[model samples]
Target: MKFDKSELQIFANYCVAAAESMAYTLVRTAHSTFVKETEDFSCALASVDGLTFASPRTFGATWYVGLDYGPVIRSLTDYQPGDVCMTNDPYSGFVATHTPDVVMWKPVFYEGEIICFVAGHIHNTDMGGAVPASLSRTLTEIHQEGIRFPPTRIVDKGELNETLLSWMMCNVRAPEQNIGDMKAQIACLTTGERRVLEIVERFGVDAFKAGIGQLLDYSESQSRAVAKTIPDGRYFFAEYVDEDAVGGKPMRIALTLTVDDGLLQFDFSGSDPQLTSSLNVPTGGHPRHALLLVGLNYVLYSLNPEIFLNAGMLRIATCEMPVGSVLNPVEPAAVGMRSLTCVVVQAAVFGAFAQALPDRMPACPASSVCLLNVKTTDTSGRTIMASIGPVGGGAGGSSAGDGSDASGANMAFLRNTPVEINEAEVPIRIQEYGLVADSGGAGQYRGGLAIVMEFKVFAPNTLVTARNRDRTLFGSWGIKGGRAGRTSLFVRNPRTADQDILGNTDLVACQPGDVIRLEGNGGGGYGAPFRRTVEAVERDVRRGYVSRQEARERYGVVYEDGRVNAAATAALRADMAEGPVEANAFFDYGPNRSAHEAVWTRERYVALCQCLETVSVGWRFFLKHQMFDRLAERIAEGEPIDGVQIVFDLFAELKAQFPALAAQQARIKQVA
Candidate 1:
């Protein structure tokens, strides 16, 4: 049953149609906002070996197109025809990136033979935890996060595991909604099984099996072809999460991508160790998790959008993550807030590729999704908790054009809940929802505008949780001389004289008439603002994206009478273009990263990484923490000091503080 080119393509399209049909069923039937509206659920058909063969293009999460089903499928002893195994624990199996995402898998059987597996996972709103949404950036361990279902049968051989399902639902705040969404996933998986069976019956089992295998191979070939276009070399970049939520220190995600002859090796061995916060990502050490979707999305998407996004692309690369690192944390480590970290992961990806594909990749984006939770008891005495709406993360500006505003450049699958839906489901009133003016970073191609939302709590004693909120301390970096995007903030009672500027918080209790304002960060800009055409500058000024004065100051384009002042614009450009340039003309890391790099110079940063390489991975995080603590202490003293000298001194202090572990880390100090 060897497939020729034409036959293989036709067969591939058929499988894709089946996958889309499955996802359509779920999207149509789901009750949770995360699934029905946000479209965070995904349905796929997998080969017997557990690699995804067909993924829906028109629906569900496109970022998880490369997820593997083999590990979890193999964890069980055996599965009957209608048996469905479910898991959300990242460490227990390769089922999900976090606990809130419940994954279910079923085997498709035809003619008394197993043909393929049908799998689907959706972001369940609540799963029983310390918080209503089961996601907390401050929560230190998974034990406090939620109920973890680790590869257990929720439906046994066509019979509903009612006892197990009901018991599980009783644990979450949104029991009815959670159960309904869980059933939606099961229904979609069952639909996938039915669709695959129909395809097998029509084409015959042998041809169907061959086609599924061929699909992955075809996708791999296309991915490899794209990989070849990237010059073979090592590209290095690092980015930080704004803060640990509980602590003020930033977290690092360092990556050195080695591209060689159409093969990509992502070396994250230099990343920081696991943290005591939910920000840790429980990736199960899988290279193709949602966080790593940056490389897959940027490269394959830019090159060929029609290629099958299956496990085939996974064959072209390997990821090297050190054990116990934040990306691959150990058991009991909180993983509720993985998406915020995903933002930094993309920064490292863009920063690295900016080195290799300067003209291709845009600057860093203020691209982290946020959740706003409201918890309170209804009049009937039943507790209610739900996410009010999805946070809008503006996309980074690109050479092709300005990034999409508010909707997001990444995680495009998660749609914002409608105002009507939020009002009806939760006890709150939406006061305002719109794009922030002058928030987008300025460049030849400007970044997208930030979204601002205000909500008034009408219910008494309402506890609100807005975890993983960031970018207030640091702005999104721009590239090619573009200025950084503006930062975000949490304002309380903005219209009143008692308006308080609240930065970021995990949770805050509120009463009736209390207002909360969330301003999402803008995406990074691309190219220099001054290099932008005067016409574009005038257009931005008119559109409220840039003010007339900002246009004159930032882009050197003086605007008057609703248009660019030609003579003044010419004079200003002449003055600016010839003036002394402070940074490189190629990349703009924004002021914060640039200032930090001045002291933590790339040379020093890399040297620090090398020095820690001598110590055990477990102790590296504490040592790094000590270094940052001492550096901050010195900086806070208001004494002008060199950052590089501070790092050297910090190492000496560490050596003296931990003499027993000096043998592990002092070698680095001695070498430096």
Candidate 2:
């Protein structure tokens, strides 16, 4: 059973290939647009203890790489060879499976003893909730989000658990589709199980385990080496989420990174309290989940192409997230849209690094993935819910150059939905999908530009649910002396008709000819614009990223006849002040705290969420709307605010006033 290094390498490769194959099969077989089109699913092989041994590189969010599967494995301790365990309850070690994601795990046995576990998760089209799709922005508790399944054997001894299956089917709107996807997940896990057994047969289980350990060790060593390269010191940074889905309050995330020797500790002590909304993250026991850790690792490892991705890289890094907070929510906490929290986590990581490596790190980019879901009755009156698009954001400016248009720095792999496919699949017209010019942050290395997407609903009363619409408080921040990117705007009409700003809600009816536009935020710049080269300014003007006036005013460069006026630019720069410009004011969720965070706190946000633990979907929607209205008034008035500074100052003051809050803030701020 003992194997050499070569044998271990081969076994590790086999596991990776098998997991990847499983992910491909799931994507090809699934029916939902979120799965098939967006490709939002993942597959992994884990030890019987629920620790991930191998994961797919192309599927799901990269953050789940470090997730531990022990909770799910322990829940299925009595599972037999033919049994399959399923659960989406955050409290039961499920980190935000929510309703759309149906997670299934199967045990792989070698010689009568369980040796490994195969898990496949997919985002189903519907999971029996208040709406056609199980997206609840304002859910206060888990029950209102959807049916909670604890670690339960969904398939026992090769037989389908009809009772459980029937109950799930009866609850969701798209039972057939959900059932089909579930079968697809089962098939994928079976494939992985078979492949894993083959690896064990060829290399022996002992050698296979050895290889896993070696791979992890190699990764950890490489990560430690990278950490050593970073100056040994404590660096702090912070990031934000504009609001919980219900818009009850803007959430702040702070990190204080302690880098001593080669060890890196990310403390999330100063983060905002747990919300009464569905944006909670269930970290299980791994502090913000393994997936997020994997994402951060990937980004750091990406700096050195030779570094291998394994548990070894994470050995030197640790995260401390407070329980009952947004990053590490407790039982019964509504976690339907935990991805929002994940986005903030990514921002925090970037923020912490920005402090340590200001010259190297880029300004903050527009972070969240905008989800637009359109639902309507087709010709035959059958309800159809299709993902209209996942809008892209601007990239952060780096030392090398300005960010690419519509490129997300952290989420570089994300892609926009094809227009041809959208038109063919649904009754809608794509009016405009192009970059928003002059939106990039002005700097020596300018920030990337966001996109302006406009579409019209062809059918009557088409329900539109657009989430992550505004960046009022959490607009991307600049590093060094760079400028912040423009905030995003969601308007019903542009130029011609009166427009209504959209908020988080169940449905907004749109008639034919009504236009909807989403202008995503640009990323922050890295340095002062006046320091930029004349050639760079000219190129931006030629490419439409900068207008002639903006180039002269922001960059202190003048352009004429599509070419830079070198003499004029030099003169302008000479006249420009040399000292650092004032930092842009902070953005706020609303005009006042009473209109934003105060409303949620007044509603006993934590208590409200606890009560919602057993409520229905409709009730969750009502609660979210109620909270949103109170915050929206503040958001509307807080017009042109600095969200980052507000949260940063508020958390700083809170930590000073209360020791417990300070301890929590310290944990969160440590990674900053």
Quick one: best TM-score, which candidate? 1
lDDT (tens digit, per residue) of candidate 2 on 1-672: 544666655666788888888888877877666776776676788776666667777665455555566777776567688888888666776643576766778988887888878885676666756655666665677777667688888889888898998999888776777787788777788788888888888777777767777766766777788777778888765566766555455566667889888788888766655667777777754743564564467456656765655445677777887666677766677777777677777777877777676666677777756677788766777766777667757887888788877876555345567898787777778899988787777777888998888998867878777754546455677666667776677777667757787643435678877888887878888777788888888787888888888888888987777667788888889877465444232211213322444444422444444333323323343443444454455466875434334333333443465476445445545655
Q: For residues 248-364, what per-residue lDDT tens digits would candidate 1 score against the true structure? A: 577778989898989888888767778778888777777766456555565677667777778887788787787678888888778888877876777787778778877887766
lDDT of 2: 0.69
TM-score, per-candidate, Cα-based: 0.94, 0.83
Off by over 4 Å in 1: 287-290, 378-382, 561-563, 610-620, 636-648, 658-672
* Count of backbone clashes, every candidate in sequence: 0, 44
Q: What stretches of model 2 exceed 4 Å from their correct place?
A: 1-10, 244-247, 291-295, 503-507, 561-563, 577-580, 583-672
TM match of model 1 to true structure: 0.94
Shift of residue 613 alpha carbon in model 2, Å:
22
